[model samples]
Target: MGSDCFDESFHGYGEFWCLGDTRPYMRALGAIANLAHRLGDVDKSIAASTEALRLCHGDNMGQRFVLSSLLLKAGRFSDALSFCQVWLDPQYDGLNRPRGGCEFNPPNPELLTARLVEWHSKPWSPGNLLLNAAYAAFGLWGDCELARQYLVLGTRANPNIFVKVLARREKPDGPYSRPRTTNGTDEAHDYRWLTQDLWAEPEAWVWINTNRDVIDIVVKTCAREGCGRREMRPLDFKKCGGCRQAFYCGPECQREDWQAHRQACRQANAPPAPPDSPVYAMSGFLNDEGALDAMTLDNSDDSSDLSDLWEYGVEVEPY
Candidate 1:
């Protein structure tokens, strides 16, 4: 029962024997995937599940089912569905019907397969339903109607879990909670809060406070900024000369003053000021003059956006 005993027993087994022994490997991979998920490593979970699927090759319905589960968790609904359908199809059903063997005989492989097929067919039962819905909504996979169908089914099967999974995958970056101040007040106050100041900044702080590495933040910011759309090559922040916080599509973008990123660059390089300083005390400053100018221009074009900025600026002195 102990891990040492299992390890000792497992070591003597040959690779083909280990790979062919569906149940143990399936269980191991499933556990790995589940642990990875709980630890917030969806990519690891996906990798483990993919391995499980590969090992399940022939007739391993249990492993196949588990593979689908992990793929769903990883937001690969279409792939999960393909995996499910492969084994669940009527032609494959007999292949999955377990042959009686020593020390490991599935009680009812047909019944299990039937249950899984039914579950997967419903567009809900399996967790992948929500994943499919998300892909559908983003127009990554299918039509909105199909997405709606999956969403409805997914919600119907397990509303709370479905919603949670959808919300989590939608943000793949992580959960969305209003940031708390040191005093624990909701820190998000305005657009500036959304953009400037660590205490007030939403995305960067979300990345920093959540313990995400700098490289991860750069990758995410690039994705959000549609670097892919611009045909821009990815920038490696690790090689950056300064604060190493900001990432750009290229040297031109890095030099583009229009983005008003110098302040962020400066803050990244500048040592932390005293806690009592207005920049810290007021939460943040509008040091990005280009951003300010853009805002001013935008306000002149459309008064509504500026009204809140004007009111907030008047009520709170510039840091």
Candidate 2:
């Protein structure tokens, strides 16, 4: 079926699909990706997944989940890490939301929700992405430090899912199966992954809400040597004028930090390099897909937590 699905040579291309109807083509590529993964062809899986992502309505459900998992399974940890981080990026909508020229039903409505359609859409999926990041960190880079950091964030995002993750962390058992969340009040409302059975320990799910710290601790640290104050530092951040990467408590700290920051800063301030990859870019282009044009470019919805308070269903304190 995978081969049949991808056999464009004998495909029946009617005008019905020229406009174009991306549903079948996207599914075919996705199928091919899975087939390649099962065959242990990592590069082929990524290539198929990447091309599938290029289809007009290709941001359908399970796309990123498949791509990320396949990248991990292939032992392409760096690629997997980069892919997961970017997809997890709230600003980039490829995996964050449904976008593309055409509309197709997501593979699992329960796992992946479509926001614009509301009742008709189910954009939220159960996969815990931060866990994948942790894996990409530890498995790929052997960076347990980074893995623990991501784990902290992952656990905070879905503590319910973390219950199982932490349990497995303690056990380190083989054949890691799909772990479900028990936090929700109703058992029927539980969330699970689409590719649970395939990998010994792939990724898991996050449901309902977020519990990540309102502000990241690292992002708030003062740049100056003497004053590395942690929190209550300031709601308002003062960014360096040079690299614009470093933040400080105020102008005084920014000036003070400059001497020490200058040497390392020169390298980053150097001439721009070529685009990293077809799937990654710093600005202007959105890698190759440009899927952000759909659903996200409008900017009607912001990723900030304060934005969550605006939701009608969100439980918030009354003024």
Candidate 3:
């Protein structure tokens, strides 16, 4: 009945029919272990592969290799190393080949080539594997020179692989290098043409400093004030009363208590000014004397008491 069942199970599959009853269970368990390992459940993978190895009696080299790989993934370095040593032993060379009378070339060279290429492309590949093994051996077995050798190899493969390797190296402690100021001044260079002198234009200046804190403050203040593309005006200077350190559009705006600028103005203007001296002269006021003299003539001979004077001449009333 068991044979019949096995035959029924193996009916459609060529490999199943060939390898017979035991091979199916061994292959199935091995596949499951590989799947578990890929899923990152290393413990389950180790268990499944161990069961497969027990059932196969160490005959399946492929299964053994997979188990060894799983052991490495699970961080069982000693066991994995032992397994790899045994598998790669000269005595096991013939055993690594496919079973007798198998039509397929036993150890497919194409698969090996593809695997090697894939492993070589990995960030931590053959080099990392060797270094890790060497380091592990040295650290656990009190071999300092071996550890140093592995450390060197690891650094050559990937400098960042070991943190200690970089511990002694110095890194830039300040901002990155940038173009130097053209004038060779410590002040930062300004690129805005508006800040430069141009013909048929009034000269203006801009102070550019590399001090990031000051730049940040200016940018933030401009944003908070809703200042837009409109050029900052001189009248804006009136709004900054406290220290004359800020600006606005005009006096009306400065007086607009809604922005609480009046308080600032009061604070600024509150400081006492020196009294004007007699030596300080004031400018002349506007004069209307010429117009007053032109209207001073008298005319009283007309029949109409004030008709001619009212019409064409200046009337001087006797009062």
In model 3, the Cα lDDT at residue 105 comes to 21
lDDT of 3: 0.33
- Which of the numbered candidates is closest to the native, going by highest lDDT? 2
- lDDT, ranked from best to worst: 2, 1, 3
Model 1 lDDT vs. the true structure? 0.34
lDDT per prediction?
A: 0.34, 0.42, 0.33
How high is the lDDT of residue 23 in model 2? 53
Question: TM-score for model 3?
Answer: 0.28
Model 1, 174-248: lDDT tens digits are: 211332221111111111111122112353234223332222222323212444422211222211234333434
Relative to the true structure, candidate 1 reaches a TM of 0.29
lDDT of 2 by residue, 1-319 (tens): 3344333343532111223445566557767876776676878977877666544233542356556656566666676666655555445554333222112222111221244123211223223555566656666544345555554554444333433222222222221122212121111112123223222343322311121331342125776788977534223444454444465677667556666777665655455454453222312212123232111111111122131121211122212
Which residue pairs in candidate 1 collide? none
Report the poorest 10 consecutive residues by lDDT, candidate 2: 293-302
Q: Which has the higher lDDT value, candidate number 2 or candidate number 3?
A: 2
- Backbone clash pairs for candidate 3 read 236-248
Residue 38 lDDT, candidate 1, scale 0-100: 59
User: Which sections of candidate 2 miss by over 4 Å?
Assistant: 1-20, 56-58, 93-127, 158-319
Candidate 3 structure quality by residue, lDDT tens digits, 260-281: 4434434443543333422111
Show the lowest summed lDDT stretch of 10 residues, model 1. 290-299
